[model samples]
Target: MATRTIIVPEGMEFIRDELGYAPAVRVEQRLYIAGQIGRGSDRQLVADKEAQFTQVFENLRQVLEAAGAGFEHLVEVTSYLTDMRDLPLYMQVRDRYMAGCYPAWTAIGAASLCGAPGYFLEVKAIAELD
Candidate 1:
């Protein structure tokens, strides 16, 4: 079997040193990005929910770009939210980023997110390479 893997960038050592995981991975025809929160490059959560969501997708965009993929290539999305009330906002954000095609998706409420008070969202994506 052959595999293609993407290692985290330098200074994102937490993904490996702390979390013991890669941020994204590609095997054959699929790219899987790990659940991402609203935290910015500076490691601080965006001040607002909608803004955070935007930043999150932008961050995911970078990850996908690194894997030579795009939102249109996505086939599935799984989102976890700390509050159900944020679902609409989440969908709106998703629409903003996803544009025309809709991928198979599921967004569910969670009791908490990675032990954070302000964070209310985490999203993962699976995209097809062919």
Candidate 2:
């Protein structure tokens, strides 16, 4: 099987140079996306909870797009939140992006993530391309 790495120019420096990992890797019809945090194109974490959640999904969308897939193609989604209290806000943002098609999902409460201060959440997804 051939593996294609999905590279996002805005996120490549840290994700590839610093972290040494591809943001997404596609093999066969399946694409595996790395855990995406609420960071801007510049790699800085967003402050507001709602904005952070949006950024996380936006990042996922970018990777999926690069892989020739969309939200509807997502087969599974896993989200990690530092605070479960933000679930309501998360659902609101998620609905805005993924209302029509719902994928199997898991939400986990994380005490902390990657030692990044002010980072509150991370989302990872698996997509099956048509």
Expressed as tens digits, the lDDT of each residue in 3-47 for candidate 2 is 676655454557877788888888888988999888888777899
Best by lDDT: 2
Give the distance in Å from residue 67's predicted Cα in candidate 1 to where it truly belongs: 0.4
Candidate 2's C-alpha runs over 4 A off are 1-13
Every model's Cα RMSD, please? 1.8, 1.6
Q: After superposition, how far is residue 62 of candidate 1 from its true place, in Å?
A: 1.0
TM-score of 2: 0.91
- Point out where model 1 deviates above 4 Å: 7-13
lDDT of 1 by residue, 2-21 (tens): 77777465445577678798
lDDT of 2 at 120: 84
Candidate 2: which pairs clash? none
lDDT scores in order: 0.83, 0.86
TM-score quality measure for candidate 1: 0.89
